[model samples]
Target: MSKSIHKPGFVLGDALDIPTFKVLKQDGTLYKGAQEPEFDKEMALKLYDDLVFIRVLDERMVGAQRQGRIPFYLASLGEEAASVGSAGALKPQDMIFAQYREQGALRHRGFTVDQFMDQCFSNDRDLGKGRQMPIHYGSKALNYNTISSPLGTQIPQAAGYAYGQKLDGLDACTICYFGEGAASEGDFHAGLNMAAVLKCPTIFLCRNNGYAISTPSAEQFSGDGVASRGIGYGIATLRVDGNDLLAVYAATAAARAYALEHNAPVLIEAMSYRLGAHSTSDDPTGYRSKDEEAQWAKKDPILRYKHWLTQKDWWSDEQEKTLYAEHRANILAAMKAAEKRPVPTIDHLITDVYDEPTPHLRQQLKQLKAHMRKYPEQYPKTSGRLDA
Candidate 1:
């Protein structure tokens, strides 16, 4: 039973007709009737290597957190293709605003092992002066905004930054990364609406990883996942297989092109899963069964990429072994060196915030020093920093 219908203001068909974008399948095969996006051998190798590096980073850091070596950690795990692929699509000068778990993006932008470890260890040399938690990576050269802990705060900020970029008349755009968990926040709606109305050049990349902490996606939203919501807000939206790195890269590259040409916003929903616990503080086994976890393990992005790379003669098992060992050794050595580095000096705390420490600010610093001195044994590592 079909009937003619129309809304005066609406032009597109119903939401269900809107396509979900994808390029690869779980068996390391292409879609039956779809053509794969073309990429040269060198570029494909670069993407594959970045995925391997990030997977190693996530694996080792989770172990470090378990051993009480770091305060906290988040795993990108199954979502590597989404972050790395999207970041790979952006120009070096483009800005990146990320929620936690987008470490892959930082690594892709050439953030070093020492830089990552310095942030984790709160070392004096850390760019943020160790103010942020581990995995909250940002780099000035990379133009990646420092990650904020509050959920969805970056969403609206991304829109405003994109607007500013447009005013500057630059071809650059802003890409903000968030999880499905962050999509639940009020700021997500506000950010999308603002970007739409203002026609800001922002790309909202949502890593819909199927869980918000222990809560499953089925329990989180009754509507069709995050994609439908982006369409509702009148933004051009696409959903790609998050594990399919090629698809994500293709989609993001196209989105980047559109945003640059039109100064408009685009929403990308990358459908992936959390291959590890939510964080060091979480226990997924408590809420979800191990069998479910086992299923996702088979779809690991690293393995999928390795299959395709080997199929294309771009990689070998021996090369994979060498690469993993190299990154693992580098990360361990860097972490040890970074941990032993001294904490940020007392003056660094206030220098970046104000022209000079005011009378009241100076007094507060004095009080902080006094407290540290009063409890030297317990605050030994603090070294007069208030945050410690």
Candidate 2:
């Protein structure tokens, strides 16, 4: 029951262009026809505080990495609103599956500064038992899945998880975060297709931040952007200015509602720029020009939101100064504390995989201990200490 064209033809993918949704201007003013999201002062202040916290945390952690305190780090830098703003729109009960850079999302869910530091430093207090690298954060309490190293793995996993949620009759959806580069993975296709076909309540948020660890978006794909791919998968799609906090929040709130109401999938493509180097190990100077970075810097999401708060008489310059100073001191103290804490004991390697350590795992741990004893200098003495 389909109408066909008389001549053989194909839809021109490149001809499709998705408009970027924006609510606030760079100067903190709303666009002529744009509407602000329904955010109360308390919620707004909390989100703003989170933005400041993550910005400060990113700055301090990057410095720590440079100082050889932490092994590696990633900075959200210019894309704060993309993570924090979207998180602000979601309910606490909803599950979140994030790529590494969505620390802002974790922070929004009450992940403490100390928790971040513990994970980054791989300290004993870390919930992950010092297994994950810096920025690989997760919390069962917060409903955030533990981040895995492989890119795009969370996409399909989120789809399946959301289906389970649907079957359970839960009043929540699953939100998955990833970069534009990860969208190129086959997992993205499989996840989107599965969600669409299964009618799972899921939101796939893509931070199209212009690069995937040095490869620019121009080289990554040829379509209009990631949003186009979402449409291709038969999912509702929204494109938003990632630097606009109000825009991101509004769009995500809408996406969540639509997905839950219809028991369907939605895709959000946040257009942003990675102002900082991809990670501590990267140097953007090699792949991008300083001028390009400067242009994006002018659109800093935190500053824009700060201006809007000040305009509404909610925040002031004194408060801004005090906040920056306070967060800086707090993050530094947490980092120092985490640095001094001992790493997880050797037994942790064999634990958490089963109800009890299996015989093979115990043997493996015994072998590891013996290996460490044979070369004490090769490993940290504290890490090798096991209960006798």
Candidate with top TM-score is 2
lDDT of each: 0.87, 0.93
Tens-digit per-residue lDDT, 133-181, candidate 1:
8877778888999998889999999999999999999989999999998
Q: Write the per-residue lDDT of candidate 2 for residues 116-219, one digit (tens) a residue.
A: 99999888899999888999999999999999889999999999999999999999999999999999999999999999999999999999999999999999
In order of appearance, the predictions have TM-scores of 0.93, 0.98
Separately for all candidates shown, the number of backbone clashes (residues 3 or more apart, or on different chains) is 0, 0
RMSD (Cα, Å) of model 2: 1.2
Q: For model 1, state the Cα shift of residue 105 in Å.
A: 0.8
Scored against the true structure, residue 14 in model 2 reaches a CA lDDT of: 73
Candidate 2 residue 313 C-alpha distance from true site, Å = 1.2
